[model samples]
Target: PQHAGISLLRVLLGFAVGAGAGLALGAAMGLSRRVDDHVRPLFTAIAQVPALAWIPLAMLLLGIGETLKIVVIAKAAFVPVAMNTSAGIANVPRALVEVGETFRFSPLQMLRHVVLPGAVPPIFTGLRYGLTHAWIALVSVELLASSEGLGYLLVWGRQMFWLDTVLVAMIVIGIIGFASDKLLAAVEARLQRWRTDGV
Candidate 1:
């Protein structure tokens, strides 16, 4: 559980920063054509770069610290959330916007009443994908930089030829990832219920 806790903390911290940034950026881009026009190309280019690709440069900069791990994991979590959020907002029905406009809703009012509620589903989808990505990245970074973690266990087991250790760690990682996914899914379901019931 110690090893598992380390991995979970790493994932949560990194994913929170990445997903928060993604949500903010995506909201701005979705709300304003100018922001999208300027940012989308850069976002697209960075999105194409794999999370692992940043490790060497990050190591050079941060020198194998926890900050490097967080940055690497954040990179992994950012793209899907941003893209999904942008798509979600863009896909908010035009009719709803028209109604909001007809009602003379202020910008904030329109966002609160129409855009956010519509965008939330896709944002949650993004969170799911981001969690998965963060999990993958955490293990990857841990394999390289950590002395003790499930990923490090995989590495150590391989070196010691302890196949059972490797297998057990792999199983633990899988179970944790699966459980986290289900937790997020349940939260999403509850949010959907709240929206449906107008809570």
Candidate 2:
């Protein structure tokens, strides 16, 4: 239970960082073609590097501490979210945007009322993908470094030849990831329903 709690916290923290950064970057890219052209290539290149590739560098810079672990998870989380968000926002119907403009909506108001709602389904999809990937990265990081969390527990179990502990940790990670995805999916469904119902 203790390890489960720690793992859950790490997952949630990673989600928050990933989702926030992704949303900001996504919005920037979506709102400006110039910004997208300037940043998307770099973002794509960096994201192409596997999350595991960052472990060595994170350890060197952050010293295998909680910071390193979380940073890895966040990075893993951020890429998908940002990419998806950008795609979602950019795909928002031009007609809706024009209607917003016709109504004299400011840019921010237009985003809030038109663009965001239109983009939400894809945004949520990205967030779900991010959360799943982040969990995998976090577990790998914890198994290799750090001294707490379910991943660490699994590592410790391996050293002690305790397959049961390792099995338990793996199960817990899967369960948590599934639950998180379901929760997000429910939220997405609700939003879709609200949009469709014109509520």
Candidate 3:
């Protein structure tokens, strides 16, 4: 239970950091052709590297600590969020944008009333994918280095040749990840309902 809490905390912290950065980057790319042209290719290349590839480098730079775990997880989370967010915003209906323009809405007003609503579904999709990635990365990091968390539990069990313990940790991890995804899906569904109603 204690280890589970620790892992959850790490996941949340990392997800927040990644999501914030992703939203900013995604907004820039989605809103500005110039930014997209400059950054999209670079981001795509970097994202293709995979979070696990950063482990050794992160360990060397940040050491095997909370910061390292958080950074790795954040890297894992941000890519999907950024990509989805950019797509979402870019795909926001032209009709809605036209309406905003017809009303002479300010930029912030257009974003709040037009762009964001249309983009909510995809944004939520991004968040869901981001969280899944974050959790996976966190476990991989914990398995490689750390003395606590479910991933560490799995590693410890294997090292001690405790098959049952390892299996239990694996099951628990799957269950937790599934439950988290389901919860987010539920939230997304609710938001979609609201968006439809508002429209």
Per-candidate TM-scores read: 0.94, 0.94, 0.94
C-alpha lDDT values of all predictions: 0.90, 0.90, 0.93
Question: Candidate 3 residues 86-187, lDDT tens each?
Answer: 999999999999999999999999998889888988998999999999999989999998999999999999999999989988888888889988998998
- In model 1, the clashing pairs are none
Which portions of model 1 show Cα errors greater than 4 Å?
A: 194-199
Q: For model 2, where is the 10-residue window of minimal lDDT?
A: 190-199
Please provide the root mean square deviation of candidate 2 (C-alpha atoms, Å).
1.5
Better of 2 and 3 by lDDT: 3
Q: Is 1 or 3 the stronger prediction by lDDT?
A: 3
When superposed on Cα atoms, how far off is each prediction in RMSD?
1.7, 1.5, 1.4
Could you give candidate 2's per-residue lDDT for residues 126-171 as a string of tens digits?
Answer: 9999999999998898889978899999889999999999998999
Q: For model 3, which pairs clash?
A: none
Sequence-dependent TM-score of model 2: 0.94
Going through the candidates in the order shown, the clash numbers are 0, 0, 0
How far does residue 22 in candidate 3 sit from its true spot (Å)?
A: 0.8
